[model samples]
Target: MTTFYAGLLSPCALACAVALALTGTAHADDNADKNTHTLTPVVVTATMQDSPLIVVTDPKQPRQPVPASDGADFLKSIPGFSTIRKGGSNGDPLLRGMSGSRLNILVDGGMIAGGCPSRMDPPTAYIAPQLYDRVTLIKGPETVLYGPGNSAGVVLFDRNFERYTQPTLSGDASLLFGSAGRSDQNLDLRAGDSTGYIGISTNHTHSQDYKDGDGNRVHSQYDRWNADATIGWTPSDQTRIELTVGKGNGDAAYAFSRMDGVQFLRESTALKWTQEHLTTHWEKLEVQAYTNYADHVMDNYTLRTPDPASMMPMAMAADVDRRTSGGRATGTWRWGDALELQAGVDGSVSVHTHRAGGPPGSMMGYYKDQPRMRDARMQDIGIFAETRWSFAQSQRLVTGVRVDRVQTRGYTLEDMAGMEHMESMSGVDAMAMMPAQTAADRGDTLPSGFVRYESDLSRSPTTFYAGMGHVERFPDYWELFGQHVEGTLDSFRALQPERTTQWDIGMQYHGDRVKAWVSAYAGVVNDFILMHYPMTSMGVDYASNVQARIAGGEAGANYDFTSHWKADVTVSYAWGENLTENRPLPQMPPFEARWGLTYEATQWSIGALWRLATAQHRVADDEGNIVGQDLGPSAGFGVFSFNGAYRIDRRFTLSAGIDNLFNKTYAEHVNAAAASLAGYVNTTRVNEPGRTLWIKLDAKL
Candidate 1:
């Protein structure tokens, strides 16, 4: 596999060759207390607002235009997030204007189901946000304790394992170098006592093929790797148990596809349990279980070459897989400080499969020697409850409820030749045959909820909130077996089940040099699940149900006007409509903004950023929602960047940046379009990238 991803670009020399092949260790600590600690001067733009529509980021610090090998480029550094660009990495993430499964992404809370069907791997493309350590976002659809349609909200990439105070060892590492021949590496380690602990992490990234600002080029290249492990026990001090495992793989190169993804592969495992103060109001109890899998492959011969005017001109390949499994349990209660509670039950299930191979040239392992077939299967089960009530003296109220039972099953008509070879291995143009069915079960019973109210103003450090939510989504799996319905023989028993109902309001502020926030929302969906696409290329691809309307907002701030100067700002907006065809709304995303400045010095820092965006002429252009669509009206731009950091102590730190510092050639309006590759330069969507530079280094122990 390219020499194991080119030796993972030296993750501290593979963690010192796995610590000298296990145990022939070396130790040396205490270099004057690790240089008297002092760090935290990088994170170019992540407006941090941890309340009022929450957003908490910190994936091991280090941000700025790069650093984010995935998880949709670390959620586009936050501000109502946006992505759909399918080039440099897997892209696909949009919140506010909502996208796929109404945005609920969890990792560590388990759920990784992406087996193409034209999504080309999403679920944050198998995540790898610096091997996760915290990233929470909750906006809109308030909360129902994760899972089950988020109505454009919910994101968690958590990981926190503590309890090990006596015999210990810690770790961290990083390296990067960017701009076209980008590179990355990371490492993390841990060891323990206090009854247990063990952790490990690994990462790698690669890039090449980037050019834009009219300097053409653009077939985007990529490479990736990951490794993970965790084990915990902590036998006392309130009990605990944990386990985790992971694996990852990658390949990418797509100028908006026509095949190329050459496999993604991933596998995961999880288990957890906890008990804390277990009585006095039954104060805590939890449990979890999980499994995740994704195995994808796409090909037009590794990474392109076969466009001799499209339509299967040569070799081909397709392979898909999904597994997914789930479990959850929760309990917590309290009353002393007024109130608190949480109750839970959760579930999941998935199973999809596919297979296909070549047209000539034996295509290497020919779809790994074919034979997968299984079509579909999905599942969900739920029960939840949440609460918090601090009645007066600063007021508070928060609530939640959930109930679910969703299902889907398909595969008969003898699998219709594996769904016509999985829609002729996705280069589209083929899919209209399957009219003798009997094997497409479906079911539903969803219900979600939310409610909120809070106040803490007495004299202002500000905090005020308002909320309301409702969800009822269940039709995923690419809106039921990936598109094409009109004379349906089962777009999985004919789509349905969308239903959102939202309203959210916000406010938050924390003083001493200022911090601020604002949020807003509005919703009403009712069966909204659109997707249509097929103005030619053999025409076909549909899926319906309408009546929509959505609203958006996001705002941010940070000030510090001088203690080394600082400033920040943010804004975001989204709007949608299709009130059953009244128009406007199809990949909506426009009106964005950002600005920042910084100087700080205690260990050095410097920063700047700009980024505007605003031309999106609202047009349903072939609609959208399942990875992408609506590639029409769009044009707006602005870009600037800068960065610097140093903290060459506390075990090291160094950062750098310069992304599109001026070579702007924008393009992003719900991207993905630009396919006519055979030497690249097809542009319509896929542009952004030019004037880049990077550097990074970090270490700790």
Candidate 2:
């Protein structure tokens, strides 16, 4: 470990020295450039709209959002994005009241599956935020061309090659230090000319156990590293091709879980082609292809001592590996004065294999004894089109439609252990029945459509829009396999697909000193997939189809005062009910509000934020028996944080902040508790981290 740390730091230190030397010589040039031009606001890809630095389109963005400590941490900043927090890093994302397979998460256009049936190494855990250029999120069922049945939405964390018209070389380096002995270092390098470009990025981060609000040392330590490179070629004015490859690995310990995360690794590759034509009616065309591979392993006795009575005692281990390959082709056409259209077709195929077993204490022993659970394959294909038309100067219409086809197959193995367990329990010398091996297949076709009308207020700086959409979603993997059920193999016996009809309305107001936006939506679902658990046989849970209705809205505003002081506030609320039972739906996020105040100057800025949540009492009567059940109404709480940043020069800057100012302890309603253990029974909701302080230094050349 010491040698690895030294190797990573040595190059960074040398690069920093070189950057400092160059900064001294480049100061005059930078000063003249800065004096002649103004800086452009940094825009995020989460929404199509452009916003200023301090404004967040997603309601979930907060300074420290429960001490993220990883990629999942940074993602929760978006509105409607939550996580199944189980202490520290590697939390699973839950978006817009949906979770697990319902949400499609991609890193650099690659899909990585986790190893743990409990989802310890969520896909997001393999991603290194510092390596990506942009993180884009599409909420709800608005866009399905990106991947398979993304009922919740799509999250694209991407890194793009630098575009240049002339020969150029650039790079940036950063170092971060924080409480709990946390440290991180990153480097980004790019070199390009008129005809091509090449780039590379790498980062490493580590942290020790952190103390929570109650001054207890939480067993949450992690170490991670990543490196990737890309090359692009542009042979002509309107044609370009790019290729990329990357790899990453890490290990971490969970404070709330009984076992430590032993090993995580990922490899990915992608190719993209873009072309623009001047003679044809089609203005542009884009095509992309990519393949991703993930290998993961988890053990009970790797990082910590294992409990004797635990299921995974004596170094029990499990492994899961998955591969995904897919591509898409898109085209845009312009017709007449007020009409334009864009169309695309995309698809992907993924296969996963899981293996477990081993000798009592040997690494290979676990694999020798355990039989394979199942091998699964999934494929999806979709075609989509969108059009924009201008009815008048102040009014416009946007419409889109998509059709998708999905197929899934799983091969089951003979249950040798199941027969043995049954014979042992019977207590009589009886012959074990042989179960036949079988294969299950499922296929479905779904359609989605949306239409919207937008207009600018007659005489004010206000824009308002109303939209309606219908989306049909295929049931996801978790709903199919995670839940316990019989005869699921029969297509007719499977849970029905979820269909949603929804309406959305929103308004935006932009002024010289104030900016505000509000949006509301209502959705009705036919055959919504709901998980139910029974208390029989030591507790069992399963998913079933049910009719449901859901409605929600979000509002946010920011105001600037006296050039240095500013205030911002945002709020969100959601409600859901099962129509058949006439009761509240499960796992609904409570109403919440966030307020912020900040002061700024040319070289420095400071800010503070306050977060508040309303107590929730609404819960489905049959929702608490599942693994992640809503434990009834939850109490509300408030938290505060402070942040600051300073620019030492054009080439250098520093940022620092303290999160959870008061170290208040609280739990989110959607979080899941760790699985029960023999000696450590943790049935309560997952607890959040305590206060943390951090400082970061950044430099560019």
* Top candidate (TM-score): 2
- Alpha-carbon lDDT of model 1: 0.80
63-143 per-residue lDDT for model 2 (tens digits): 343234456777766556667776567877776566766678877666665645567777888887766767777655555
* Model 1 per-residue lDDT at 82: 90
Residue 373 error for model 1, in Å?
10
- Candidate lDDT scores, in order, read 0.80, 0.69
Q: Number of backbone collisions per candidate, in order?
A: 1, 11
Poorest 10 consecutive residues by lDDT, candidate 2: 39-48
Residue-pair clashes, model 1: 1
Q: What are the TM-scores, per candidate, against the unseen true structure?
A: 0.33, 0.88
